[model samples]
Target: MLSADRMRAHLDNARRHLDTARSHTGRVATATGTAAATTGLFTTAVMGESLLATLAATGLGLLVLPTHKARQPEPEKVIERTADGGMLVYTPPAPPSHQGRTAAVLYATPGVGLVGVLIAEWIVPGFHWGEALAVALWSAGTWLLRPARRARHMLVPPLPPVEKVHDLVVQDEPQLYAHPAAQWWAERVAIEGGAAPATVLEDVEKTGESAMRAIIRASIPGEPVPDISVRRLSALMDVPQDLITVGPVPGRGASVQLLTVGQADAAALDPARLWAERIAPLAMPGATITAINLGSMNLSKEDA
Candidate 1:
């Protein structure tokens, strides 16, 4: 859905709005027809395939349209044009922090009042606002005991559209994109903003088949260090035990490198050909994450 042109976004929105309007008009027409019949204002003899009846039929036709052809609910989101002339459509933001006065006020406003009235009528000696105030204070104090917000941003950009690479894409560089796993791995790796990274769990071991692995830290900062041991091997499903023997490289950002073993050696990089420049760039419309490893992954002649 990524598009450099904001006009295209507007066009897409327009198309969506048009479909919604049509759906609404169809519903209105059906309702109007029903009302007219119920009130006895309209009768069959007077409406027999004449111009008025023809118009009514056309209006009713929209309702009878196949369910599969129905219009989807229009999006409430507005795709605003960004400072960079690019547009940004907001995804769902992380939940609000519940540790502050906000949470206290929320509890005090409802739960405290209700609980206080019940207590006053049954257990407490008094039925007064003062007692309610005291209960609200107690609720607020207990809420403070809960965990605090970590200031995390959960609504990262959506994943790039999974696309079909041309036939020649795999053929031209079998060393990089040959095996079915090559493109699969590339798509995972190309996910911008670090969704694919995890800690290396074990030392690299290989047979003729594959290797085992794990992770240290994941993409989000302050996220718990993942259990990368063999006990939690399923966390890194894409890392086949046969092809890539991933291990910790101390002092690296991710501290992990996927090394090619006998079977994984089939994915060895050949720099003579460049797919990044030669291939289409990944498209992520209105995404906050910058595209990486998208255009080119080969050595230029200058480097050679």
Candidate 2:
């Protein structure tokens, strides 16, 4: 029912999962086997093959057994081929942000409760192997659950609502406008350019290699501000005046067209490749409005 390529993909994924589980199980087996053997030596010397020593020897034997195996199961996802020869991958529902924290709390609870019991046992002059086992179990549970919570978050990353126009430009960290430069030209232009109290909306259709455009509808207490100057934006953005441009949008009286342009080398790459690499990943699918942060672009090669 499946193509050869699809079958091969599934098999490859399964093999990778098995390899990871095998690696974890191997480490666990070695550690547990070594601990059990050490316990056997100590107890046999003290009590001479007592019940506790016998149990340690049995656990060591189990760890060395050829038939013993351990494998961790991963969360499931659905993948299907669309009619248009496209791949549609579906991730499971996102886990809560506090999932890892909750797991840590739960795992710590038993250890907290056993603190008094452990103190009482330590008051006696004997080494309590059961207390040691309990502590190790709690530590292992906490450690193992951390990776599981992280994997769940990776499978379904959270997508918060776009609160403002600036959020579209900087998806990862919208709060911080720019890196070292602090080029928050939009806020500056709206205030100093006589366009204070402006409503900015991205012009998704007009965005391309040349410029990233937005419509600014500005107003004062009494009347609407019709236009904002390119020079003002240029000064605010801290870029060359030629890189920034402004125009009037049709049928929008109080709105001014704010166009942000990139460096000269932007048009060197093919449009399709450029869109795929730079633009497509930033735009959300089925989004009605999109933000493009092309103007006054930050180059990695720029000296510090």
Alpha-carbon lDDT, every model: 0.38, 0.46
Stretches of model 1 off by over 4 angstroms after superposition: 1-4, 41-304
Error of 2 at 213 (Å): 17
- What does candidate 2's lDDT look like per residue over 1-304, in tens digits? 9999999878776766654674475446435433543443334342333334434533553343322122223446879999999999997764443544443444234324334333434454456676566546644653455332233233333333326776566545433333222224334444443433344334332345444544444534335544556565566566678876565544344434434454434443445544554345445333332345556856686653
Please estimate how well model 1 matches the true structure, expressed as its whole-model Cα lDDT.
Answer: 0.38
Lowest lDDT 10-mer window, candidate 1?
147-156
**Candidate 1 residue lDDT tens string, 116-163:** 333343444434555445545544543443111111001111233335
RMSD of 1: 32.4
Colliding residue pairs in candidate 2 = none
Q: Residue 129's C-alpha lDDT in candidate 2? A: 73
TM-score of each: 0.18, 0.24
Winner by lDDT: 2
